[model samples]
Target: MSTVTTPKATTRKPPTRFEIRADIPAPGTPEGAYFHYTPAEAAEWLPFSVYKLLKMANARQIPYVDNGKRITFSGMNIRAISEQFTVEPFTKPARAAA
Candidate 1:
């Protein structure tokens, strides 16, 4: 009789989230920092979908740069837009007694 052994399978780990840092300027001073990203990259970092991002850009709801051919989003603008749509969790009301 021959003994048989099975090899263990290996799985790849998920990628870690990237963190964003901004250089905030003093009051009454113009901002000098700028970072641009495509819709797909923005979608990866943000919670909104690519379609939603495009819709918002079309509606002028979010700040974006349109260079005649392509549309790009700035990191600062994305942060500002996300802040405007922030929502708190809802609390359920107490059940009525019979």
Candidate 2:
């Protein structure tokens, strides 16, 4: 009679490296998906002027704050507005019902 034993094999995971990138300005935080930006920074990033920026904020609910003399918006808010304007052809009403 004889007894034999075998050692189990071990598996190794491949080496991995991850890189993070950011273009957000100062005084803001990165939430789960979007970055926040102060209103001054928002004005710079946007095409509209300071006054127009205020109007945009009020009209579009662009998420902003108005101090006694200044106003600021969050980058996160801008991202949300962008999503609202984005259109998907497939999502639109079907021209001819299937």
Candidate 3:
């Protein structure tokens, strides 16, 4: 007599995803989950003028959201964009005596 073999079940892996997160609160909105800034406001956080910010926004150099009349910069928070430009200071290593 031959014994019947049972089939093994296959397990599926979940899809991988990435996301940005911030702890700041959004302004004006009741949700207060995100911190958004206007072009004029985002300029203060960045190292450029509002005119340049607007220009960059128009050129798509920067990311922003437009709601018919106004354009706002908001990722996870206001600092989200500002933090992108953050640079660490580098120090020269000490040289050995000759």
Q: Count residue pairs with overlapping backbones in model 2.
A: 3
lDDT of 1 by residue, 1-47 (tens): 99898998888742221322344332122442265656765666568
| Candidate 3, 1-98: lDDT as tens digits | 99998998988742111112334344435554255556665555568777777777778776677666466666444455556667879999999899
lDDT of 2 by residue, 25-54 (tens): 533345523443444455565555556666
Give the RMSD in angstroms, all C-alphas superposed, for model 2. Answer: 18.5
lDDT of 2 at 40: 46
**Full candidate order by TM-score, most accurate first:** 1, 3, 2
**What ranges in model 1 sit over 4 Å off?**
1-33, 88-98
Candidate 2 Cα errors over 4 Å, as ranges: 1-40, 66-69, 90-98
- Cα deviation at 93, candidate 2, in Å, is 7.6
lDDT, candidates in the order shown = 0.64, 0.52, 0.59
The candidate, 1 or 3, that scores higher on lDDT is 1
Q: Which is the leading candidate under TM-score? A: 1
Give the number of the best model, judged by lDDT: 1
Compare candidates 1 and 3 on TM-score and give the better one: 1
* TM of each candidate vs. truth: 0.52, 0.40, 0.46
Worst 10 residues of 3 by lDDT: 13-22
Q: Where is model 1 poorest over a 10-residue stretch in terms of lDDT?
A: 13-22
